[model samples]
Target chain A: AQSVTQLDSQVPVFEEAPVELRCNYSSSVSVYLFWYVQYPNQGLQLLLKYLSGSTLVESINGFEAEFNKSQTSFHLRKPSVHISDTAEYFCAVTISGGYNKLIFGAGTRLAVHP
Target chain B: GAGVSQSPSNKVTEKGKDVELRCDPISGHTALYWYRQSLGQGLEFLIYFQGNSAPDKSGLPSDRFSAERTGGSVSTLTIQRTQQEDSAVYLCASSLLAANPLTNEQFFGPGTRLTVL
Candidate 1:
């Protein structure tokens, strides 16, 4: 079985400050990693994904994550965050060749203050 | 194009009662999925349906939980004899199920929040 673990339940940072949300996974087989963001009262939207090729994947919103196979981790990072960046982030994983059912971690709430 | 949509954004039902949550996936999407979000469980996959193939019920918590996708577009998650533990947000997502799994992005609905009294 595959599982995801978000080290932090909540992260508080000031606007314009850098932030990193830690995520680690345990899987017996190769897996694909993803980050999904959920704004308050909104549905979750895909942030970015690491499927193949480069180990580092980035989203349009200046957020990036690197897949570290040795560490079994995919941590999301933002150089500088905005007030609007406050949302819940989830780390998900699925077997590379298996069906599309996603195994998600307990989300991390990002609270960006002014 | 419109995204995934779910009905009865908020539902309040008594314990031991039954409830049905509906999901309308994006048109032409061949794959649909049901997930539950709660304080205890976070987000968990409950069921999955792909095209005309047999649905996957491996993620269901118990026999009281069931789901069906008709015509490969609309899906309904039925919870019979609901309990307080069943009070959670039911989320539905759909994907195109492309030949490349990397391209198959799942779009989520606003979700139906169910409260059991």
Candidate 2:
């Protein structure tokens, strides 16, 4: 079983400012981690994923997340955010095996203000 | 050049009525999933389908929720005796394979918004 917790419900940041969205997970077995972004009136779009081999993962949109095993965290970060980045972000986890199920966090609303 | 697609983009129905939402996954994808998103909330897992075998239905909230996939392609999610609480955006997703436990990336549909009045 896997559970994801997103530490913040809302984050307000000025355009071009650095930001981080914290996510933690509890799982007895190995898990895969993912970040998804949802724009207004749209469904979720995959941002990045941490599968294996590398502790750090990045998306083409200038966002990245590092998977820390000891810390049990997969926090998303961006060196500079844009107004277009204002959206709801969710962190999800899924255990390895048959009948894999995804557990998602409540989500963090990123408000990028110019 | 197609992605996951869902139908009845918006629906409004009276209480106690039943509704059916549809999903058409990407070509050749074998794994499909159903999820619900309420106002100001994240994705809620509902069900999972893999090939023609039995589905994983552990996440369904109640007996009123049921889903079926036909010919290993399209799917339909049915909600019975709809209640106000059932009003939400129903999302459908599919993966090339059952999310490789190591790295699962599920492609999502635009979603169907249901409103029970």
Candidate 3:
């Protein structure tokens, strides 16, 4: 079984400031990690995912997450955040032969203030 | 082309009433999924369908919850004698294939917010 844990419930940062939303997961075998963002009253959109190869993955919106196998973590980060970056972020995991089931964490609400 | 779409964006009903939520997967996508999001359970996978068949229903909370896909495109999730605990945003998503789990990106729907009173 695979599971995710988001360390923060809410993260508030000033505009143009760097922020990190922490996520940790546990699984017996190799797993895929994904980060998804949901804006107010909208569905979740994929920010990025880590399957293989490079441990670092980036999104077009300047958000990046690094998969640290040793730590069993995939924490999302942004060097600089815009007010529009405020949204709910979710970390999800799916292990091999799990029938495409993704177990997600409780999510962290990111709020960027000006 | 349209992304995944769900019907009844918002629903309100008294406890013990039955409800059905609908979903239409993206064109040419062969895999579809259902999820529930709430303050308590967070986001949990309810089920997934490959084509018109559902091979995994392990995520369904109880026997009261069931889903069916028809014509290999649309699906409807039915909750019998809906309880207050069932009140949550029901989400739908679709992917290209069930195999090669890593490459399949599930496109999500806006979700139907069910409110039980």
Each prediction's RMSD to truth? 1.0, 1.4, 0.9
Over the full model, what C-alpha lDDT does candidate 3 score relative to the true structure? 0.94
User: Which 10 consecutive residues of model 3 chain A have the lowest summed lDDT?
Assistant: A94-103
Candidate 2: C-alpha lDDT: 0.90
Q: In candidate 1, what are the lDDT values of residues A29-61, reduced to their tens digit? A: 999999999999999999999998999999999
How far is A69's C-alpha from truth in model 2 (Å)?
1.0
**Mind sharing the TM-score for model 1?**
0.98
Off by over 4 Å in 2: B99-103
TM-score of chain B of each: 0.95, 0.93, 0.97
**Comparing 1 and 3 by lDDT, which wins?**
3
The CA lDDT of each predicted structure is 0.93, 0.90, 0.94
Q: How are the candidates ranked when ordered by DockQ, highest leading?
A: 3, 1, 2
Total backbone clashes of candidate 1, pairs 3 or more residues apart or in separate chains: 0
Which lDDT tens digits does candidate 2 get at residues A15-50?
999999999999999888899999988889999998
What TM-score, to 2 decimal places, does chain A of model 2 have? 0.97
Give the alpha carbon lDDT tens digit for every residue of B42-110 in model 2. 678999999755468988889999899999999999999999999999999988888565434688999
Among incorrect, acceptable, medium and high, the docking class of model 1 is medium
Ranking by lDDT: 3, 1, 2
